[model samples]
Each structure stands twice: as C-alpha cells, then as structure tokens.
Target: MRRKSKCVLGIEGTAWNLSAAIVDQSRVIASAESSYHPVEGGLHPRAAAQHHATHMEQVIHDVLAKGKKNNAKISAVAFSIGPGFGPCLRTVATAARALSLSMNVPLIGVNHCIAHIEIGRWLCNVADPVILYVSGANSQVLSYRNGKYRIFGETLDIGIGNALDKFGRYAGLQHPGGPKIEEIARKAKCYMPLPYVVKGMDFSFSGLTTAAKDALAHAPLEDVCHSFQETAFAMLVEVTERALAHTGKKDILLAGGVGANSRLMEMLNTMCQDRSAKFFAPDKAYMKDNGAMIAYTGLLMLESGAVLSVEDSAVRPNYRPDEVEVTWR
Candidate 1:
C-alpha cells in the first residue's frame, strides 16, 4: 500500500452548532458551520437535536463543496466523540460514520474539549502553558502535566458564559445572550459595583450574574450591563492570574467562545505583559465553535493511526478534557 499524507474530514455537532471541515496534513482547506435557531428558553435538547438533524447534511455538503473548490480530498473521517448533548453528537457521528464506511476510510473519534486545546496549541504554537477554556457549558483552567491535561480550577456553579447568558435572558435579551449583553454593555457605565468571586484559581459567575440581573431590575439597564461586564471580567482576570501564580506557568492561552470578549482579552493581555508572561488567543473563527479545530485534531490523530469503529462510537456529555488519551504527532 502506498502511504499518503494524512487528511481528515471533521464533523462537530455539539450543542448548537453543526459544523464540518476538511483538513489536509498541513492545514484546514475548507469548513462549514450552522448554528441552532433561537430557542425560547435555554437549550431545548429535542429542538437542538432536530436542528442538527436538519442542518448537518447541509453543513457536510458545504464543507465538501469548499474542499472540492480547493481540490482537496480527505483521507479519513473524524467526529467529535463527546462532552456534548448525546442526541446532537449522535447526529454528527452517524453522518461521519456513514461517510467513512462509504468512502472506505478510517474513522477517528476526538474529544471536543481536547480538540479545543489542540486547536489553541496549533494556533498559538506554545510549548506548555495554562489553558483557560471558557465556553457556554464549561469553564476551567487547565495544564498539560503528568501526561494529561490537569484541571487546576473550574466553576463551582455555572460556567461563565452560561451565567452571562442566563442573566442576559433574564434581562429580556435574545438567545445566545452573551453578545447581546456585551453590546448593551458598550453603551453603559459601570458606576455600580458587582461582586468579584475568585476562589483560589477557580472563578464563580453565578453570584455576579444574579447580582447584575437584580441590579438591572432596580437600576438602569446600561448600568447593570456595564457592571456585569466589569465584575465578570475582573473575576476571570483574577483567577487567571492566580492560576499562573499557582502553576508557575507564565504562558497562558485562551480558548472557546468567551475568549472573544474584547475586555477579557485586553485585561489578560495587559496582565501577562506586565508579568513578563505570554498570552495568546486564536482568531475569532477558531475562538468560536467550528469544525476546523476538530479537523485539525483528527488530522493529527489519523496520522498517528488513531482510528475507531462504529460499534465502539459513543457520545459523552460529561467528557473532561484531561481524561482523553494524548497522542502528539
């Protein structure tokens, strides 16, 4: 058999996004992403699954269309294996497996969180650093130590983004409320103070989010938004600083959707520079949920002969980033 450079088609249908990507050995050639329509309340699992089922095929087609435009053909298939809503993941997995079998290619399964970290490393090109993952469903400060990504700190109640979104919803904002809150916050003044909760290297946003919402009920909307942003950003900054101090790892990389916050990025950038430490965040495309990251991770894993079978495929809603077995290429 002739050996060929590794390429993988990555499919990621986690919570709200249905994404697909084609990655060659060197880089991502093409990608597609589709987000869930607005649900009245928070994530409605059945509705999310329905969205995935409806859009996943289109996402895959668009990804392949782009790849064909670039004359890139994948060698294998890879799908995010877990730490997401099971129904949504199953939709992607079914698509990936079907393609893999029909194309007579190997299939690789990737942990969504690990893929996030891997994409951060790929973009930042950092050797070792503390990684802060702040997304809709998770918040943690992690480091690769002792052969695994060790969690140094995490949320005690709700993830930062979740808390923010909940508060935004309570304020009569649209779904995926973080951006709406940030938009309102830009015009607001932070005259009122909010609590900043940072316990050791971990941070809590539930209290702050509650306080912000309550304040809005009695205070100006703009003021409440501004106060919320200031307090939440400060808490994140403090915890990040503490993680750096505790681990003695000056290098820090931010990943996931919350990493796109301008205020948060600016604060961390200044702090890192002042402390003579490095700080890195991926471009907006990589920061938000996408298939490119999964494709990139799958490319590496495929190159290392890490492939899986359909019978063994499963989605884990609670899969931790640190629990994945690492295989660096």
Candidate 2:
C-alpha cells in the first residue's frame, strides 16, 4: 500500500489580515490572504475581528482549493494564537478549534512573533541568527539561548511601524502609512533632524513620532519622512548591531512586515557587512503576517510532538515570543 501524504493547515488572523495556508513537510502548497483596511484610523480590534469572521471561511476554502489536497490528508491544524488583537485572536482560535475537532486532527497554537522569525529563517536558510523583528505591533531584537528566543532589545513605547503609521496619519496619509511614508521619503534631498532615542539595548519611538508630527507643521513632508526613516532605522540598526556584538552571532535575520522597507534593509545590510556577518530576509510574501509561516512553524511543532487539545487552544493576545519553547531547534 502507498503511504498517504500528510499536510498541516495553518490559519493566521493576528491583526488586519486573515490568511490561511497548507504546508507539507517540505514546502508550502498554497497560501491565501485578505486584508482589512480601516477607513480613517488604525485597526480597531472588534472591527478587525468582525472582518476576519466574515472572510475567514472563504479564505480557508480558497487556500485548500489552491492546494488541491484532500482534507483527509491534513494531519494537523495550526492557528496563530496571539500577541495580537484580542477579538481577532479569539476569532481565529475558534475557527481552528472547529476545524481540528471536525477533522479529528491535532491542533497547534503558534506564536505570531516566532512564526515571523521561523519563516525568515527557513526561507533564508539561516541558523541561529540574531532576529530583528519589526512589525506594526512589535519591535524587538531577539536571539536564541538555552531553550527560548530571548529579547535582547525591544521598544519601550510605540513600535517602528506604528510610529511611521501614526506620523503618516498626522500627515493625512491613508491607512497602512508605512509604505506611503517610504515612498515620499525617497524623494527627499535632505534629512531634517529628529529625535533618536536608544537607551541601553532598548529603543523608543514615541518621542520621535511626536517630533515628526511637530516638524510636519514647519518642515516639508518629504524631509520629515526622510528624517524619520533615517532616525528610526538608525535606532533599530544600532540595537541590532549591539545585540550581534553581544551575542557574537554571525548571522542576522530581519523579519516582520516592516522588514519590507528598503531603507531598513540597507541599514541592516551595511551593519552586517561591516561586522562580516550574513544578513537574510525572506521574500515579501513571507515578510508580512501570512499563513505560510504559521503553517510551517506549526508543522515543526507538531512533528516535535507538541499537541494542543481543542479546549486548550485559547488565544493569548499578550503572548510573548520568548514564552514559547524552541522545540524544533
């Protein structure tokens, strides 16, 4: 008799995006996502959750259809369990539980932050690199030690992405302000001064955000954006370099949605080149909040004998990356 193919189905609804993917041990078979854009402000937890609830079923079906795999071949279901908006996390978790129970497959709860790092590591083929995680909701320098990915440095206030978005809002940019800010910043010929705050190994962006808002009242928008990127990326690079120096890690990986910024990548590449360390980042597909990363990481966890009962698959909106045990490593 021929052996049956086994795959894991992963769901990711951490924030604005509702995504799903099917992954076999070797590669991702299919991935699908739907993003919710706010009309005038940042993502509202309840509203985002409602959007996920409305579209999640269709998204899952689309992913499964794209893979062309039988549901019986799925051996596990994975969901990003947290460090996300409460309502969004709960909505995803509930869907995951229903699927797991219906299929009689194992349920796995993945850490959203860790999934970002794992996908970057897997795609880039980097082992044990210091991670610079910068997303809309998170900013941290992380490294694996003993059994967990510990935070070497982190944001004391707003994350880099959030700071950029808030600044964009103040300038009347649309939702998801990072990309808009980046676009305008590229046209700037001069960089205006902005607050650069890095205390010890940690960094803060609230002050910089405030300063940028104030500067916008007097300074040109392009100059302000340019200055903001320079100052913000500098803080991130500084802390990441410090972490690399302290950990002596020969590799540095950039993960998360904000990793898509060219300026940030350039800064990191320069720092890594100066230090003679390898720099790696996944393709844009895996950089943002996506289901493939969650699926792949979940597959690793399941293969390592980690299991979650349906009843225990509750969401943890405040889940920290370091709290998860690095069993695959």
Candidate 3:
C-alpha cells in the first residue's frame, strides 16, 4: 500500500501556456493546460500575459475540480518563478499567491528549468543524468554536482526552438516552426550546408538561422529544413556527448520543449547507444512547460523543507538552475 502523500497545486504561465495541476509523490492527481496561439509572429509578452490572466481562472478551476473529485487535498501552491517573460511570470506568480492564501497552504517558488529536469528524472526513472534541456528561450547542457545543477554548456545567442521558429517565419511558415520543419524535412532529398557554430562548451544558433534564411533563396525549402535540423541537432548532440564524457555520467535526460522533436531524440539516443549509456525523456506533454512538473518538484521541496513564505514570495525573471541548491536530491 502507498503511504498517503501531500498534494500540491502548481500554476505555470511562464510563456504562452497557462496550466494547473495537483500531484503527489506517486502520480499526477489532476492537471490541465491552456495555450495561447499567436496570430502573427512569435509570442508577444504583454499579449501572452493578458491571455494567461484571461484564462487563468478556467484553467485553475478545471484542475481544482479534478483534484476535488479525486479526494486530493492540496497542501501547497507552487508557481514557476523565472527565466521567462516578465509579464507572464508576474501574472502566474500573482495567481499562485492568491491560491496559496485562499487555500491557507504554503507557497512554493519553483525554478522553471529545474522543474523540467526533475519531472523528466521522475517519469523516466533515472538519477544523476546529464540533462539536455532545450526550449524556446533556454538551451543548456547540465548535470547535478555537489549542491546544484551545473551548466556544462549553453547557447551563446538564441535557443534551438527560437532559431527554428525564426527560420520558419522567414520562410513564411507559422509560429512554432519546429514540427513543420521536421515534417517537411522528411521529404528532403539532399542536404545543404548551414553554419555549425560551437565555441568550446557553447553553441550559437543565431548565425545558423541567418545562414538558413540565405539558403532559402536558392535551395528548396525542404532541403533547408533538413540541413537546418541536421546541423543544429548535431551541435546539441556533440556538446551533450562531451558533457557526459566530462561528467562520466551514463544517463542522459532530454527535457524541455525542443526535446519533443523526434529527430533530436533519435540523435541523442544514437549518441547514447554509441556511448553505451542510457537516455531518458518524459512524455511529450511533460516536455513542454506544464503544471505537473511544478507540483511534483514542489512536493519534493516541501518534503525537504524548502517552503516559500508569502512575504518573501516574489517572481524571479532570470532564475538559473545552477543558482538553486538541490536539497531534495
């Protein structure tokens, strides 16, 4: 029999998605998400924040309703507290504060990046992995050491997702161009060369995106897509493999939104196979920013006595994973 565990209600609105979830140690009790689809280019910070504010009530209600049906009691309220759009983070932080107060439970502030890593670790059943965390705004190679997740490498300019979206927009594709790029690249017959920038432990994609924009003038769209993905994924994989070698860690965990790309996953898995190591990835739902990750990580923090007081609960727009002490671990 499972011992009864504390439940946490987590609110995530770091960017376009607004989500709420209740979870304990074993499983997600209930979770709900609402996403904003931009009409034109990339996400507008103010507009996304407004969308989160508009839908926050319904999203929270849905998860809270499900939690009630499951007889789940929320012991704390958790919120994503950084490395995100300022307006969106503030909006969600405000909501988390309200929820914590109304429910008379403790409030927990979660690092968005660490939440991704923790949830991936939980779902995939791996510990002490070299994490390849790729998302819209953040791309980092990290591993837990001593007291924190030490960053081994990161992008010098834009994240992989942003790079893909920029190239896709230039080619007249819609927002969130990663999936479309992957789909069209499957039909590509030949590969074209794009800039491959890697500086020691850091990689740069801004130049690659620029080169792809130029390639669109002569090369077929599918070819550009293929080349872009190949070059970029190779850069990421190269750095990730090096991190594993440096850390002597046998496990690799792919987290964040860009980790959902099948090609990226395949490339990382291939590298892991070559190294005779293991690779772990959570479901696509957990790959992106969501509430379950926050709640679950918060549960861990709560047990570790890492609670947040209402007076000191303020949003951090640029929280880094390495700045957090991994008390739960």
Pick the TM-score winner.
3
Cα RMSD (Å) between model 2 and the true structure?
A: 1.7
Count steric clashes of candidate 2.
Answer: 0
In terms of TM-score, which candidate is stronger, 1 or 2? 2
Off by over 4 Å in 2: 1-5, 69-72
TM-score of candidate 2 to 2 decimals? 0.97
State TM-scores per candidate: 0.94, 0.97, 0.99
Candidate 3 lDDT, 39-64, residue by residue in tens: 99989999999999999989999999
Total backbone collisions for each predicted model:
1, 0, 0
> Whose lDDT is higher: candidate 1's or candidate 3's?
3
| Error in Å for residue 325 of model 1 | 1.5
Worst 10 residues of 3 by lDDT: 309-318
- Candidate 2: C-alpha lDDT: 0.92
